[model samples]
Target chain A: MSFKAAVLVFPGSNCDRDCKVAVERSTGGHVDMVWHQDTALPSGLDLIVVPGGFSYGDYLRCGAMASLSPVMAEVVKAAERGVNVIGICNGFQILCESGLLPGALMRNNTLKYICKPIELKVENHNTAFTQGFTPGKSVWMTQGNADGNFVADADTLNAIEGNGQVVFRYVENPNGSANDIAGLMNERGNVLGMMPHPDRAFEAELGSDDGAILFRSLMERVAA
Target chain B: MKAKVHVFLKPGVLDVQGKAVEGALNGLSTVQGWANVSHVRVGKVLEFDVAATTAEEAKAQVKDMCDKLLANTVIESYTIEVA
Candidate 1:
């Protein structure tokens, strides 16, 4: 089965192209680059990838301005319709700011930008974004961001933890995020928001090809 | 009406920026009382004009804006002032 995915492109979304390439290479799917102001997403999208970057110049806060872009309205609608959605790095921040997912991505506790390959343990492999990997498998990916610390209220933390909403945890904490969360999925399991840069890890030359598993998993779901 | 909105991170959420600033202030031993500064939280102010005839109306409108966009209510609290 042929899968189709849309990659939303905000003003400062530098990683949009990388995400497109990754999806096309990993999933063998057609990828469309959607502008933030387009006001609509392509119909029948099997997946929506909100790629990493400092959208809107990281104005106000990372992803805050981009979250309000017209296209996000359509993205929210698609998510509600049960289409698979993945937000990476600044994209994750945008998802949280848009209220599609719980919590926020605050500044790193170290107050410095961190760019390095890191290991993440797949905490919940049942979701469409992680089903390609075995349960509790450890994967390598690149993380490059300044405001990647994930935060939430105590009640929300408890609820997400108890519900198995956390999909990935850092092997070694990098940004002081609550519960060392690197990736999280919504309760419905159709949407995922992660701080790491999976697009950057598309090949072993880039450090790891483990990120392909996510796109591959989505493709399998679409084919199924 | 002219409105000013102040956004601040809630208490309990670690303010790394504020802590860094406090550390710098404390390092300035050349200035008296700089060392005594504590809990030096940092926040942001946004000023804009709205089409409201009364201050109450402007305040309410700006407060709504704060709740919607100017602040992330999950981690930040906002105060609105209108003139």
Candidate 2:
């Protein structure tokens, strides 16, 4: 079975091409590069990836303007219908700003733009994104952002953790995120938002092949 | 009528920029002779004119804007004033 995927491209998104290439290579499937201005996504997509970059030049707030783009409304609708959606780095910020996921991405505790490969532990292996990995397995992926910190109220934090929604956790707590959360999934586990760039690590030539499992897992689940 | 909106990070939330500015102020205290500056918090203010007849209407409209877009209520709180 072949899977269909789409990579969203906003005005300032620099990682769209990376995501498209990774998805195509990993799934051996056709990938569409959807522009942010387009109001509708292609029909019958198994996965939608919101790649990283400074959308709208990080105006007002990171991902704040991009979240209101025309295509996001349709993306939100697709997510509600249980289509697998993954947001990486700035895309994660957009997801929170768009209300597809809860909480907010705040400025880094160090107030600096950090770019490096950090160790992440798979916290849950039940979701479509994490099912490829064994629970507690460690993977190193590139994380680059100024505002990568995740924050929420006590009640919301409790709810997400209690519900097993957190998918990845930073082993060394790089960005000072609440609970060292590097990634999380929605209540239904169809939508995931994470600060690390799995696309950047999808191949061995790219320095690591740890991220290929995420794409492969998506394909396997959708084909099932 | 004119409306003003103030957006600030909630208390107990770490304001990294605010802390940086506060550190700079402390550095200047010995050289510039400034005194009694203990802490600092940074926020944003947006002021605009609205086509409302009364201050109450303007405030209500601004509040709606804050809730919808101006502020991310998860990590932020906003106050609106109309004149």
Candidate 3:
């Protein structure tokens, strides 16, 4: 079975092409690059990727304006219909702003734009995105953001932890995220939002290939 | 009427930018002999004109905007003033 994917591209989204290339390389499938103003996504998509970068020039907030884009309304609907959604970097901020995922991405504790390769531990392997990794396995990927710190209220944080919604945790707590969380999934597990740029790590020449497992895992599920 | 909206990070939210500004101020105080400052927090203000006739109507409309967009509410609070 062939997997179909779409990568949403906002005006300032710099990672859309990389995400498209990564998806195509991992699944050997063509990826449609959808613009933010487009009213709808392609039909029968197995996956929707909200790629990284400073959307709308990071005005007001990193992803606040982008979350209100026309395409995001459809993305929210697709997520509700159980289509797998992966939000990376600024995409993670968009997910939170869209209310598809809990918590907010706050400015980094150090007040810096952190750009580095970081280690992430797979906290849950039951979801489509993490099935390729063993529980507690560490994967290396590039993460860069000024507002990658994940913040949620205490009760919400507790609930997320209890419900196994955490998909990844920073091995070294790079941005001072609450509970060291690097990635999260919605309650239904089909929607995921993460800070790391897995698309940037899909090839060995890019420094590591650990990120391919996430795409491969989704492809495996779609084929099954 | 014109409205001004003040948005602030809620207490206990760990304002990193505010902290950095406070640290810089403290360093300036020691070096340049300025007065000591404490509990320095940063917030944003947005001013815009609304078509509402009465001050109450303008405040209500601006409050709605704050609730819907200007503030996250989960981590930030906002105040609206109309004149």
Question: DockQ: which candidate is best?
Answer: 1
Q: Please write out the lDDT profile of model 2 over residues A83-178, one tens digit for every residue.
A: 999999999999999999999999999888989998999999988987888666699889999999999999999999999999999999887899
Off by over 4 Å in 3: none
Worst window of 10 by summed lDDT in candidate 2 chain A:
A128-137
**Candidate 3 root-mean-square deviation in Å:** 1.1
Per-residue lDDT of candidate 3, residues A1-224 (tens digit): 58899999999999999999999998898799999999989999999999999999998887988998999999999999999999999999999999999999999997889999999899998989989886656899999999999999999999999999999999999788999999999999999999998999999999988888899999998888
TM-score of each: 0.98, 0.96, 0.97
The segments of candidate 2 whose C-alpha lies over 4 angstroms from its true place after superposition are: none
Q: Score the docking of each candidate (DockQ).
A: 0.87, 0.83, 0.73
Each prediction's number of clashing residue pairs: 0, 0, 0
lDDT of 3: 0.92
- Candidate 2 yields a Cα-based lDDT of 0.91
- Candidates sorted on DockQ, descending: 1, 2, 3
Worst 10 contiguous positions by lDDT, candidate 3 chain A = A129-138
The predicted structure with the larger TM-score, 1 or 2, is 1
**How does residue A106 of candidate 2 score in lDDT?**
95
Worst 10 residues of 3 chain B by lDDT: B30-39
Which 10-residue window in model 1 chain A sums to the lowest lDDT?
A: A128-137
